[model samples]
Target chain A: MTASPPQTGGPWRATGTVAALVVGGLGLALLGLLLGRADVSVLGAPLVLGLVWAALTRPTEPGEVVVEGAHQDPDSARVRASVRLEPPAGSELALLRVGSPSHRTVDVAVAAPRSRTVGVSVSGVRTGRQRFFSVVHRETSVGQVVGTAAIRAGPVTLTVLPRTRPLGHLPLPPRLQGLTGSHDSRRVGDGGDLHDIAPFTPGDRLRRIDWRVTLRESGRGARPGSLTDLHVRRSLATADAVVTLVLDSRDDIGRDISTWSGYAELHPEEATSLDIAREAAASIAKAYLEAGDRVGVVDLGHHHRPLRPAGGRRHLLRVMHTLATATPSGRARPVVRPPQVPSGALLIVFSTFLDDQASGLAATWCRHGHRVLAVDVLPPLDRGRATTGERNVYRVVDIARADRLWELERAGVETVAWHELAGDERTLAIGLAARARQRSRPR
Target chain B: MSVADRARRASASARVALFAERLVATARIWSPSKSRPLPRVVADIGPWVPVWLVTAVTAGVAVASAAIVTRGTVPWAIVLATIAITVAQPDGPGAGIFAVTIGVLLVASGTEPFAWPLYVLLATVHLVVVLSALTSGLPRRARFELALLVAPGRRFLAVQAVAQPLALLGAVVTGAGVTLPWLPVAAGLGLVVLAWRLDVRVGDDGDG
Candidate 1:
């Protein structure tokens, strides 16, 4: 830290050392006169000459300090900011300080009398909105005789959407809706899967009749004569599944519970429960949408309008965006009522399950005849620094959460730990998805 | 603008405000909340170490030079006190303390005008004067571009070139029983005018 920045922008001024030298030189001259010593008075001669030189050589204008071109690759963790520095003519060097992702600071210095744009990179960033490049800069003269005011420019920010990951085929609602889709339903109609072969009656399509089966049945002689009782192949109807993702964003706690009281700060790099929840929700929504299923989202915290169910790539983007913006409400209001879901839509809830409220909502959604899958999005606890009392508190909370998860399982709402992995080295969500596909398959 | 345009602008402004708030929401409590005063030194990174080194070296050189010139307890006390003062408040008027003390001590010692030690003492004095002038009023953490020293260096050499020989000439002329107090004053004025006339602009020619 070289100089304290002034609150307001001001013109250049001489440094304190210049004033000190001037006063010291003058005092020596006086002392020399008092003592009648020529050498003593002349001892400070170089100082006076140096001051005169510095005075005449000071920079005339405040140079430019501009910062622009902030870039962050979606697939990469680094954020780069480009800064343009033009220290005025007499300036020896210019210094720039910039704030990076997760609120870390970086500094860079460049020799002045030149205009240059320098790029600084910051790494280890996660998905979210952040102030990428806030810069403070100034130019100082040689000997720092005089310098311009320290100026602040730009705290440029950008929002990086939550990333989507691939998942196995997910579970569907008990009943599928819509006429045109990739998935087959229980309702009998024209589809890819043959439902059964039965004796044809009036209104049966003639093309669906199987002559080979009719002849075989006639040989058995149960009820079929030659072409007397035609057999027609029937297939299931094509319909799309509708899934609603319920995100409990009321409390964004981390593995370290010490910061729950808001006194100790939780750094940005530390992944919070909400961050995990968003990634999980986005992955599920993408999977469902890609499978020709309509997916929607509900923020249990903000009882605001939940996203309506829809299909296609555009709706998938909309779901991801909504998931990205889901943030912790940071307050407690009793969940007077759970956010509403589409009738017969599958509910895959993402939550920490810290309290019974979120689990209770999943149970309630299950009771409504929707196939509910409650995802426990809590991160692993860091018990290394926990005190005896803190561990006890955490133990009590864990017991209650574990019971809530157990109750969810008993309620026939599938439960999976989002942070856990299965034998295949995939997230437990993939296991949940595989189980869902098995249950939806024709028995 | 149309009413729809005005609405759109308002919505955009609100969105920007919300985005800024979200960016600082969790961050403000950590590094972004309380103002972390940027030590306005223009280095690429933290310059506290380098600045501390320069200040320490300069202060040591200044004290040593003051001791050599004065060789008196009172001068030594005053010069030593400036070091303490620079630490407590670098922007204070402590830098000239040493130079003034040395000059007074030299006169009391009655040293020869052409003494070699005095010339050596003068060299240290120029260094202190230039460095102290650059660093005294600045923050202790101030980082300087090394090239910034070149101008002061050149100025030091230029002043010494004229002042040293002129001092010898004064001693010679005084031995001949002739006194001229106005000679140093005239020479200083001449140098200043000459420097201004030359008016070298470094930024225009080579890459800054």
Candidate 2:
């Protein structure tokens, strides 16, 4: 449905009204002077009144203008708007504005009722909910009479998300597999393993006590029998491993894109690059939870996203909630107050991998005994698309960043260069699994 | 008048005078139209030029304007001659320009016959003021360029001697003759800076 006409107090209408008043007053004054010598006092007032009435009671006809929205480019985070004005039947419309500083206006002309549409395009918008409040139409006859109308379009919004990349054959963290070497089930229960014998406490299981020792001890003396049965026992109970995602948030975001040529494209509801990283980190948390491994999220963006290192469904959900709500500020330098990290916690940092600060923060986490994984969100360079200056700048920044990366590498931060869509949990989980496999080798 | 009355009167007059002086200084520093030292150059030229050039231009303009009003029109020949010497000596463009303008004016009309001989002393005075105000020395780049002039390279000295004075002569003559409205000079300098910036991207196609 078309919008109602705008209230006629805007700059254009004000100018129109002023022009009408000036012309009318001057014409009336001229008429009064021409008829000055005659008895024309009564006629003069009527003449002035008629002009004023005509100027004030000018009729405004209504019309419609369609405002079209679309993503102008795959890489651009902006939406473009094209406004087309369609006037009434048998009218020609001109001087139409879809959106003004205050209100949009259109001026049109009609020859026995004819109608037409005019279109204008605006570009170079950033990410947000953009609104086109009203379409303004002003119709002017060849006789210099002007009428105005407005068509309101929308409270439309465009969500621009970061571009995604494909994940293929990327490996998971090493320690993701269950604790090994301490409990091999095929070796047999207490066969070449120690079966424990202890003083029979109140809640001691009767199955584990040695019957002959207990009987002999009870017969020999009234003292409580120390239940020590000589049998092999498993020394290692099920040891829990925790995964903590340390996300970096201080880098400048790259250009946004919704799809990378597939159905499983990046979602635009995600706000920032950090939000994408949060989502990826949460996905990893989900995987670790499914693997029956304990998982928790340490939102480097949040001081309280939990560094407790506990894992379960509840813990995974906590991580997801933290990811959904945490806002990433642009302070990329490693914070002075280090996160309270549990020992042997795996820290996976999901990042765009475009800036040095993120890598630096990951390195800091690695130094503190956290197994760090750096996921890159940038695609492989498409040289044909980049300009010479852009390529040169990219090379310089890349080289400098490479030096930092080498430092992180030396510090034992497991650096993974996974493009945006390339960072599904399978790739991360496999990477962890490979590390686990390598660690489990017979060294 | 009584001593008490006189003291009160003196205090009131002193306060009024102090207020008047503050107003005058504020007006001088803040007016965009007024050609004060630092803001004048910035408003005219964008900030890419070395800060020393700004200081030099400021001092050079101040001293040259003072010399012109004190000493009438100097000849173009002597200014050109000084420019030749300064450029030949590898003098900085600013110093050379200032020397030439003052030198020519002295030589031509012979009004300030002393201006030519006093060029080195004026520059030295300006240099001291500049160093003191900056609270350090001139930046490395400016110092390096200035050192080239003082060094005993005959060709360098010759170029400095010629180019500097010629530039100074041109600046003064043009500044006085054609740029009657001083605002136009600022606009012209801005245009020149723009042209230089536009030229910088021409040869380098990101090759470096």
Candidate 3:
């Protein structure tokens, strides 16, 4: 953070109001002197005295203002910019202008001889990489008649992340790897799922012995009705699943069809398609990570940015930070297919099926034996701003998108609409995970 | 240059080109539109409504008082109305003109010094000027904290305190039939010296 230079903004220039008062006062008193009307000079006394006081109290030293930034409250979009004002002696009010989207400006009368932090609120800001604390501030001298030069402090670069919804059950990989995790693995070990029933071995614990089975086997053995051999129950080992979230940042189109073209940029305040994709990817990653599964993130448009699969609460934050860096790229290096993930990792592709490129890549992943789940991140259609020709073009593109989605289904890829997931009901997600678990069951 | 140098140069150019593309893509982050509904980010102009209303009413009061104090005729009233229009604007020069006009009328009307009307006009002029300065040069929907008025109020009181006494002294000197030609010059010189004191650094490494 940088501080505004010491007001060294040159001497405080007198405002027009000060000149008005001086001119008015001097004119009256001089005229009274010429006419010997002492009453008139008396009448100008207040104005003259007022000007003298104002001149005496004007700011002398150049005071610097350091804008100490405060982050926006997570629950709201109002960014409270806390500015610390170190005003010169006898300075009056401070004017701060927060220039960006809203161009909100505020005036606060700060009493001198002490520093003060004023919080100016900025609302309706869009998510993504944006600037903050770009405050142009100056303190007023007597009566705000004169003040220091305006100084701009900073345009601090901050990446505001997209909002993520808390998702319910998310699908997992076919073969979980970690021995100590949430899902049941087919490896023979002690766990919740039954693996086998057999005579107890030397290494098996007494807790594994099944009393009814032991008695039945003993009766059938040489020692009738007596415990001849110990029987035990064996269960499958618990393992963790790996899930990699692939985000398609090719285009961040908004609901308005007209703005989809490269000529017009989407409104920064509204949630664009990339925002939806990031939010959906974050939600899915969080859900899988919460289940003690290893989760990763990859940008399809920028293959250079990738996070290897890892399981932890910290890793979830890393996933979110990576997602926030996904700029709405219109032109990126072209690729034949999406980046590869770990073997048997669940690949969830978050994309706007505006074209066949994303669907084709997802199908390729599915054909490569990775369970690919496609999430549609297109905003709902509201053709209020579109012309008749644009609307017709949208309808044609919409149909082609639907066909591509159908093609994905045929290619064994499940497409989930991110926005259509109503409330807390996640039956589709639960079913998908349950079906994967069923497939991983032992014969 | 060798073949290796050409390859390296090509890679650097490619990187630069990609950077330019990304920059161009995000050139227009946001733009205001009538069709797109405004985002719900506090953009509240709620604080300025009362300030503007108060300023308008005060300007009206100043105009009415200026006319009444001067004992204005029809032509004077019309001139005062024009001044009122000037006062309606931000940082208007109307306060100076109105004050001077009232002073001219006081001299013409043979009004007694230290009269109640004189006091009334003085305070009214101050009020109008200060209030106009308070809302000067700000854009529509600009906000101002109420605490900002504290300094202006203090300055107003301090000025009035000194000015009222001088007003009485001038009246006494003239009433007693005394002549002091240097009084006006001395006040003028003091005004100059005081004005020169602006932005004078007096042992301040500002701990403000």
Candidate 4:
């Protein structure tokens, strides 16, 4: 996309080197004449020649700078800027400077055109729109004469999606739906795994009858059951899982409490809790969606930018794009009411849990019979150098926060600290293994 | 030694170590690390003060010194001052004028014929003016690129490689009262023009 309108060419201006040569030459010539020093006069020849050469070759036309690849992925976008000179004959060197308010400025120099591209790698430090404001191009001649032009391409805006980390198997909701899926349903239906055996009833499929069990029962005793009472194997049905991710975007606190005083002015390099929450939510959504489970997103603070439950690669992209656009709404209150999630769908709520609002929402969802997983996204606190009074205050706040989490656990809402779950492959593996063992054990 | 005396010595050494640590910290704050790149150095310096103002002041001092040594006429001083001001401006086309004026002032002073000290000082002043002019008002990000671009050019300007010996040889010949012919000067000028024309032609071909 065009960043800004291209600037028209301007007149060439003499650089310092050109000025030095001219001034030095003229001064020496005058001194030689007054002092009758032929050797002194002879020294000015090179300077005079340089001046004449500069005059002969001064650029008559200004150079044009065209920037391409201005739009970049914040995570891995490399911006390339190119300047194409109109009559590239007189120019010796060209320098281009690119800058944005949020990022460090970069300058690239290319020897006279045959236009070459200067590439700059940028880190995706923050989410939302990033704009590059100034781009200046300066060209110099062999005589050191400088010609400069400023090109204001339309500001290139790159929307940086929040980065995601690899997540292990996520907890499945207690209930499942639909006939076709990966997870086994407890009820008997047509499936791969046998559930139990019982006497065949009316409308039972002939193929389902267990011939071995029927023959064994017939030879059991004098009171053996008749053929009408044949046993049939029952299989558990497998159904798909639906997951709803709730993002608490009210507060974004970093590790340093003092830095939080100017929360809005914090640099993008310093990620806050909201950043972690977005990342966690994105990771969880990706893991489930990759597993063929339908995943949806709910922004607790922003009513807009919600994605409906769906499953596919395209749906994952939509969910990630929505997650990247998430910003803290700066609301002091919790969500007025728990968001509506589909029945039997697992609800994953990402929050810092600094206040009771997020925990209350998770508990509410749990009360409504939906399985809720509350993720504490707060960064670890560093209290190493704090004063006694400050430490006491922090202690009190930590205690209160811990009590809220305990209450969530008491209400049957499973709470997981993001730091504890982050990159912990064994936790999910062990949990899944235990769940499998439980399912296989005889009742 | 007594126990008290030993304890006092230990305390004194500890205080010295503490002072040394503080001194090093202060030094680090004032002096940038050598390994830092040009752009970082420019950013640390922060903000621009017009280069011309600084160049003007330095050039004025150089001119005043030349006047004192030459006992020159007021008109001569005026001419020198004007050249100095022009050279000081990074954008002005007065570098040749400034160099010529310095040479004339040196000759008029009639000090030792090949005064190496005077040449060295004048060269230093010229170097300062050129550097100030090139770097002033340049954006911080551009400073690193400018540094890279100017390296070869600066090497070309290091007059010691060719100009210093030529100037000394000419001074010695002139001191011996031998009148030089114009043929060599004419030939040199001809070669310069030929090189310039050749460069222009090559540039034109490249453009095509």
lDDT of 1 by residue, B99-140 (tens): 776676665566666455455566676677666655543445
Q: Kindly report the root-mean-square deviation of model 1 from the true structure over all alpha carbons.
A: 14.0
Ranking by TM-score: 3, 1, 4, 2
Give the local distance difference test score of model 3: 0.67
Report the first chain's TM-score for all candidates.
0.79, 0.47, 0.88, 0.80
Residue A146 in model 4: shift from native, Å? Answer: 3.8
Model 4 lDDT tens row, A2-48: 34445545677766676566566666667767777655655654555
Comparing 2 with 3 on DockQ, the higher-scoring candidate is 3
User: What range of 10 consecutive residues in model 1 chain A has the weakest lDDT sum?
Assistant: A1-10
Give the lowest summed-lDDT range of ten residues in model 3 chain A.
A1-10
Q: DockQ-based ranking, best first?
A: 1, 3, 4, 2
Question: What lDDT does candidate 3 reach at residue A238?
Answer: 92
- lDDT by residue (A100-126, candidate 3, tens digit) is 553434443333434666555566435
CAPRI classification of candidate 2: incorrect
For candidate 4, chain B by itself scores a TM value of 0.40
List, for all models, the DockQ compared with the true complex: 0.20, 0.01, 0.19, 0.18
Q: Could you say which candidate leads in DockQ?
A: 1
The CA lDDT at A94 in model 1 is 60
RMSD (Cα, Å) for all candidates, in order, is: 14.0, 27.7, 11.7, 10.2
Q: What order do candidates take by lDDT, descending?
A: 1, 3, 4, 2
Per TM-score, the best of the predicted structures is 3
lDDT of 2 by residue, A293-336 (tens): 66666655545546455557887666665555555555534556
